[model samples]
Target chain A: MTSAVELDHVTVRFGAFTAVQDATLSIEAGEFFSFLGPSGCGKTTLLRTISGFIEPSEGQVRIGGTDMRGLGPNRRPTALIFQNLALFPMMSVAENIAYGLRVRGVSRSARREVAERLLDLIALPGHADKRVDELSGGQKQRVAIARALAVEPKVLLLDEPLSALDLKLRQHMRNELRAIQRRVGITFIYITHDQGEALAMSDRIAVMNRGVIEQVADGRTLYEAPRTAFVASFVGENNAFVGTVAEADRDRALVTTAAGPLSGRNLRNLMRTSEAVLFVRPEAVVLGEGPLTGRATEVAYEGILTHATFELDGGGRMTATIPRGAPVPKPGAAVRLGYDPADALVLPREGFAHA
Target chain B: MHSSVGHWLILALPVAVVLFYAAMALLDRRRAPGARPVSFVQRNGIAVSTYLVVAVGVWTVLLIVLPQLYMIDLSFRPRLPPTQMGGPNDVYTLENYRFFLYGSTRSTAAWNTIHLKAFALTILASVAITFLNLLLCYPIAFYMAKAASTTRMRLLMLMLIAPYWVNEILRAFAIRVLLASSGVVNQALMGLGLVSEPVDFLGLDLGLYAGLSYAYLLMMVFPLYNAIESLDRNQIEAARDLGGPWWHIHLFVVVPHAKPGIASGCTLVFMLTAGALAAPQILGGPRTLWFTPIVYDRFYQAFNWPQGAAYAFLLLVACIVFVLATMRVCRLSLGEITR
Candidate 1:
């Protein structure tokens, strides 16, 4: 099918301040797409633009092959789940879920049937008459989703709907959200600042920084092969080094660092023969009595793993997560750190920072 | 014309009352030492309790239930005359109320008839104004509340407040001038070529009513807007997310949340408009009359204080009844409506 949603160089500026810069992406039907960023990073702004709450300053937003520039939110075949999960507190759960259909002028009984089906689908089958405030956070979340789906929009836009819930509920709802998106087979564009939530649920994620998408890739690609130092450090803890690419030929490049020269995967897109940041995932770094050594700055025991932050004497920092039962490194203790050449991806010096 | 001991008693009452209250407060404190610091409590509480108790006791004998009783007693007495009271032969009669309630002289009767007729017209007019004000106020309040910054909202809010500073009478006068026969209003209409002749607004009820409503319309706007403003926009969005359209959002979401504001605005407008004197007197030429004017005539023009007091009392009862009916219809308490 037509890519579920297409944003082509969509730039949204509020006066002189650009909320979303030249951003473009394509989300296929049935795919769960997430825009992941920190607060003020423009993820929600992008989501609002897609939902037609805002118009792009420079380019157009297309959903299912139709331009969405001038359409009002209600006129579009799109629904947005606000960050606050804006449920009508005065309305019954059934009434809230049936809102979109009712607005579309569906007949009463037919709307009821659709609402009943949606309530069942969201797994709140008998909560039709319940007030929104009476339900728990997770229930409110599902009800919001059901409401958005009630309109049967081609794409559903979620602006941090799960952000308000506590950890366990948020975790549970992540899977529920993914399942709902799968069941409905609609494009789901979720905006969130929570890394774990994005990683757990998104079919593909566009990691954003300063109103720009740093990288868009599946969970594995994003985690294992982050294209920029920001993405590498942001997605997970990474041991990075200041280095200049010594040479490159297609896929493998040797980078010279202060500590020593190291072999690494060629981030050809972002690599240049100049001083750049090299990122090795914390898990990818192997610790043993070999190679270079560093002082352990801190250590944390997380039941499943022993994480240690290593301070390089020459320069830079690295984090290594070892099995829980593994020998715990005490603070001030020295430890050797090394990683596979495949784990180290050196990005061009300039692509790493927002400036 | 002064009663010697009674006047002296009234003057001395304040000091005597103060002493009694002080004595009572000391007794209360001795019985119940509160959790607050004793020194602070003794310092503030002594003065506050003394003042409060004395003031309440005196007011009970003065403002509260006394004025009506005094009026009733005076009504029984004849009109001020040296031959009537304690000096000659004091006598009581029901003739004042009888004569005033249904005027004795033809001129008095005509004025009394006009006064009684004013209430129905005022009530109808007030009801219409209140309803329309509620409608107009809701959207403005909603928009003001949603403004991103308090400063921006306050600037727009100043427009409403600015008009308030202009005296109601002046505003009505301004409107009167505009709507006068062969006045600016007619000039504008003629200038626009919409009318062959100048429309006469002076000496007519319609002109009076338009001026009155224009002056009082702000009263309705403030409360209804406050009600709409306090509503959480998120709730509306939530309803919309649930797929609700304009009607559903308004009916199931916005209206219920704003009910208290609407009721409060309506009640206030009803109360003020029913007894309104300023707007009607200034704007309403001769044909449009109001209830307060009737009460005013009885009090001053007729030299019949008892009948005037009775009419005032009747108006008070009408207000209470109107309030009770409004609250009962809304199925809420006055406290809930006001908040």
Candidate 2:
């Protein structure tokens, strides 16, 4: 019911601009995959390459062990749901859904029956006679999905289809989309800039930046053990300390910064005297204990958590997130912060430009 | 009763036209496909004060209705002699219209053809020109709107419009010169060895068709470009992703989306070609006697103003009928066409 999609050293260029540069990846069958990135990161370009909307300037694309050379979008066995949905406005709901079926020479009665069944699947059983303009935003989204599924392709590609919806509806449709994908058991390749959507629904994620794929890993592994500076900063919030490594071991390194010496696990095999950065998650920062001391500068009260920012005595700042119910130290009061060696990550410094 | 009769006498046509609009509105509200039915007030919105409506009513009656009523009145009067022009004996009768129907019966010569046959030929030629312009301009418009880059599209638009900067009569006369027997086209044909002798292009009625088509080229291209420009490109891509072929995609998606533009372009080109007098008179050979020229001859050359008005009135009716039939076939509303 599903097929794996593979890209081998694919590069796409538009005259003087390089859109997607030398990309290589393989997505497994029946897996919910996502490409998450900021805008202009070439995630959409890579998705379009896979869906055959774009032909790579160099290299090959394979789907289910078959080379898709010189194949157009219409010739491939994949369907793309556009960002704006792009349902035919001149058509009724049923006609929009049944369009692919009709194009494939399906009988009129069969098309109607299939359209009706898909309408029921999308939870709009009696909306066949309604025009597209009459439907709500969410209903149009479901109709777009139903229309794509009527062709029953081996892979389904979505291009930020939920970006136009309100927040509440976007969250609701996330669950609905996941449930439908699971029931259909097809490969779903979703593209979005929203990390929440990727983390919640995808089995694995490929974080892209500047036309390059920074990292690809399962959701848990990607969050817990990001390999590069871009991945660490992009996936979630982290307190960064720039310094030089003072001591190195098999799995641990001590970095010397202006404030003090900090110890963390050496995930990137740091060497002594090498420039490095130590990252500590806000949740892992412990108050009232261990090596470093600072004065509390600001305390922000979120609904479920409290974030307290500490200015180290020498330089630099770090934030500690505590449960809201926990008592908070007064602002301007001296505070001590520490973390377990395993909770901190030390890696060689890779310069990453901020937006 | 006398007062009621007086009111009816003044208000009958206006009341009928209003009733027609009401019936159309009701029908539109019931089953207008793919568009929302907007009420007249909704279309005008809160800015439509009573003063605005009254101004529009006055303008319509004064500018459009009164002139047509005068023309109808003139069409029914007898053509009096020069000494008796506007005299009491210039009685209202159907004699002028009867002349158009039977005047050619007195002349068996082929050169003085019947008025009815000429009118029918004019209509058929106009329809053919409309279809030809559509076939030729649609692809160019689609390319300009969808395929060509912005720079290229701008250049193409400039090229299409640059010729129109010259007067229309000047353009037609230029075409007539180019299509003459000893002009550049015939000289090229002879030089290429396709023909040993110069062919008379005017005798073939080619000059008239070419001039008319060129005169109305912009009228066809702009509307189609506008319509195709507004189409969402994603819709075409979606259809392709669903495994539809190129022509099938056009048939199901692009053509239907451009229907309003096509209808408007066809109507304009058809009406202009049908009522054209200058192009035919300049480009036609002795054999090309179109309806407008015949009407013109009646008024100016033959000094028969009543009969000329009758012929003009018939041409107007034919144009209206053609417009209605086209709207019916395309399933477009007057509002959509005007928009």
Best by TM-score: 2
* Candidate-wise lDDT, in order: 0.77, 0.88
For candidate 2, give fnat to 2 decimals.
0.88
DockQ of each: 0.41, 0.75
Top candidate (DockQ): 2
Per-residue CA lDDT of candidate 2, range B96-212, in tens? 766777665244344334677888889999999999999999999999999999999999999999999998788888988898999999999999999999888888889999998
Evaluate model 2: give its lDDT: 0.88
TM-score of 1: 0.85
Give chain A TM for each model in order.
0.93, 0.94
Q: Give per-residue CA lDDT, model 1, range A1-355, as digits (tens).
A: 6987998999989999998999988999878999998899998888878877678899989888999877767777788888887776667888788877777778989988988999999999999998888999898889988988888888888988887899888888888988888889888888988889889998899999888899999988998878777788789777777778887767777778887777778765434477677777787878875456899998988889888898876667778898867777789988887888876787766656532
Using alpha carbons, what is the TM-score of model 2?
A: 0.89
Error of 1 at B87 (Å): 11
RMSD of 1: 5.3
Where's the lowest-lDDT run of ten residues in candidate 2 chain B? B1-10
Clashing pairs in 2: none
- lDDT tens digits, residues B134-159, model 1? 66676777667654378877887788
Error of 2 at A330 (Å): 4.0
